[model samples]
Target: SIGNVLLLHDLVQAIPGEVVRWALLSAHYRQPLDWNQSLLDQSRKALDRLYGALHRAAGVETNGDEPPEDFLKAIEDDINTPGAMATLFALSSEIERAMTAGDHGVVARAKGELVAAGALLGVLQSNPAEWLEGEVSDALRIEVEGLLEQRALARASKDWPEADRIRDRLNALDVVVMDGPQGATWRVRT
Candidate 1:
């Protein structure tokens, strides 16, 4: 029986505690969970997307909005965490859309709703940049930033091959680079 038990401490040592929590809550409470690396990976990515939305909307001001009705209804319906999580992702997408449309009011309200909903689920409460980037050593940060700078120069000079090579190198280091109107920003892969 002891051999069958997966220790929470061990899991947290390898994965973010919130991610582990997310994975456990992903299934219906009454259902048996087929726990595996894939489930953890999925949970991590899902959380990343949610945090990414929050990160993009960081500049907007929230007004203490509550979780949307659908989310509350799902939780009310047999503590349906899966449904609630889906609602959270849908809200994240809405936040993204609002950000793209330059609708700061909508973005702010949706972000507040998302954070409130996530609190009910016991996830997504961390600082988005810190959570998304994880912990990086100062030396490693400098190396990654230098490489990013080089990649930027390469791209600016139309040296596509060099830029691709640098990107591949960054991928090898488990650093994901995202390009936007503000140019390239990166997060260490979780």
Candidate 2:
């Protein structure tokens, strides 16, 4: 229990719980952590990708599927969390493939298995939706949209420097601008 009378008055700077969890989970227990905000940010993004795969698998039916045997074996061997994490990524890739194939049963079962396995590893404590939505501001979105438009105009006029400048500004704000054949899209830096 925190019994310090001045605790509230001197509340420490807070980092989000999810970020901290991911950051800690990023390294093995025996390894020293060079704790930093950037590490946490990267961890949060990694968690986002993991949950995004899960989100995509939502609404699929499961047929009593189980986590990969190898993953389970790795953890059972010696609490080899890093090994488990690697296995999780591999499983996620399989889930992604199943989702792409529209195999609802496989998708559902894969997700269920993943969640169960994650529980054993102290991960995936939050709902996929929480990480999926993220914490971007409406104002930031509007500003990014405007900047994207400016970038487009700059590119259209063969203003390479101007386009690059706009892109750099977006990067500064942690907005990832992806250009595809269909069009350009911006995502919050993950």
Best-fitting candidate, scored by lDDT: 1
Q: Per-residue lDDT for 105-183 in model 1, tens only? A: 8888899999999988889889997887779998888999899999999999999999999999999999998775546
- CA deviation > 4 Å runs, candidate 2: 1-14, 62-66, 136-190
TM-score of 2: 0.62
- Quote the RMSD, in angstroms, for model 1: 2.0
What are the clashing pairs of model 1? none
**lDDT tens readout by residue for model 2, 38-106:** 887787777776776766665665456466787788778676677888888877887888877777777
Error of 1 at 85 (Å): 0.5
- TM-scores, each model vs. reference: 0.89, 0.62
Give me the overall lDDT of model 1.
0.90
Top candidate when judged by TM-score against the true structure? 1
Output the worst ten-in-a-row residue range by lDDT, candidate 1. 178-187
Backbone clash count, each prediction separately: 0, 0
